[model samples]
Target: MKVVNENLPEEKPRHLLGIGEPEDIVEGVRLGCDTFDCVAPTRIGRTGTIYIHRNGKLEKTSLRKPEYQRDFSRLDEGCDCAVCEKYTKAYVCHLVRSGEILGGHLCSIHNLYTIVNFTNKLRDEILHS
Candidate 1:
């Protein structure tokens, strides 16, 4: 698996396989991987949890719990997707707690869009090189 990534042409678009670590994401970009995705993000989100980086420290918030019952906030401040723009964390948490499938679907869709946009930005960066 590593051999394939090591052998990928720098000028041709290639995807890094099975990258789940934050450090690996940096390495993959350095290796010229224009696209990358993982099931971890959505898998975590669907469980009423969220990943956050605060002061360089990673934190996971469990939204399914009663603590976030009235806490309304965006899923991600940097995310430009419709879900992030309009929906609140509290609402999503409610959906998940109520077993509403839309919660998972919305989270998955926004997650995919974020990944797609990130990859496109990387592709642009590669093209400019």
Candidate 2:
């Protein structure tokens, strides 16, 4: 990235493709990347996994695991999206374990929402700093 940045105009935006982890995004931004995109959030959500922001970092959890069987909680306590607003962890866990399509759909919704919210917060912090 240092080498790449050296050859580009400072005022121009640099897009970092196929990178999406919060930590990676921060690193890429510091190294001159001004944009990023990836299918990981949706892909992982399809597999019954989702991201959550925790302790100032991104954390992931699998809904198919037995641990969620009795746990009743929203996908994200801080999220107010349709999925998080109406679904419980136990329900989503059942959907995933039962091979229901709505499981993936709900997961996708939360994953995308999480990323979008995180980015918005990031932008606000950057602007304020």
Candidate 3:
């Protein structure tokens, strides 16, 4: 990314493809990427995994796991997405466990929100700096 940034015109916007992981996105921005696109968030969410922020880092939790069966906490404590605000890990887990499509949809919403929000914050920091 650094090499590409160095070779490209600084005035041109950099659009990174197939890059969506939070850590990767942060690094991409630091290396001069202006935008990114990928299906990771929704793809992983469909498989029952969702993103969560913990200790200032992003992590994934599988709703299909037995551990989430009774976890009443928000989908992500740091997130303000509707799923995190209105749903519990236990309920989402039940939906996943029962093969309900809503579980995937909720997870997708949360994951997409997380990435978009993170990117927006990164953009704000860069612009303000």
Candidate No. with top lDDT: 3
Over 4 Å off, model 1? 1-12, 20-23, 51-60, 121-129
What lDDT is reached at residue 37 by model 3? 99
User: Best to worst by lDDT, what's the order?
Assistant: 3, 2, 1
Q: In model 1, which residue pairs have backbone atoms overlapping below 3 Å?
A: none
Please write out the lDDT profile of model 2 over residues 1-129, one tens digit for every residue: 879987999788888899887778878877878778999888999989988656767899999999999989888777788999899999999999999999998998899888888778777877899
Question: 1 or 2, which is superior by lDDT?
Answer: 2
lDDT minimum window of 10 residues, candidate 2: 50-59
lDDT of predicted model 3 = 0.93
Q: State every prediction's TM-score relative to the real structure.
A: 0.68, 0.92, 0.95
Worst 10 residues of 1 by lDDT: 50-59
Could you tell me the C-alpha RMSD of candidate 2 in Å? 1.3
lDDT of 3 at 20: 95
Looking at model 2, the pairs that clash are none
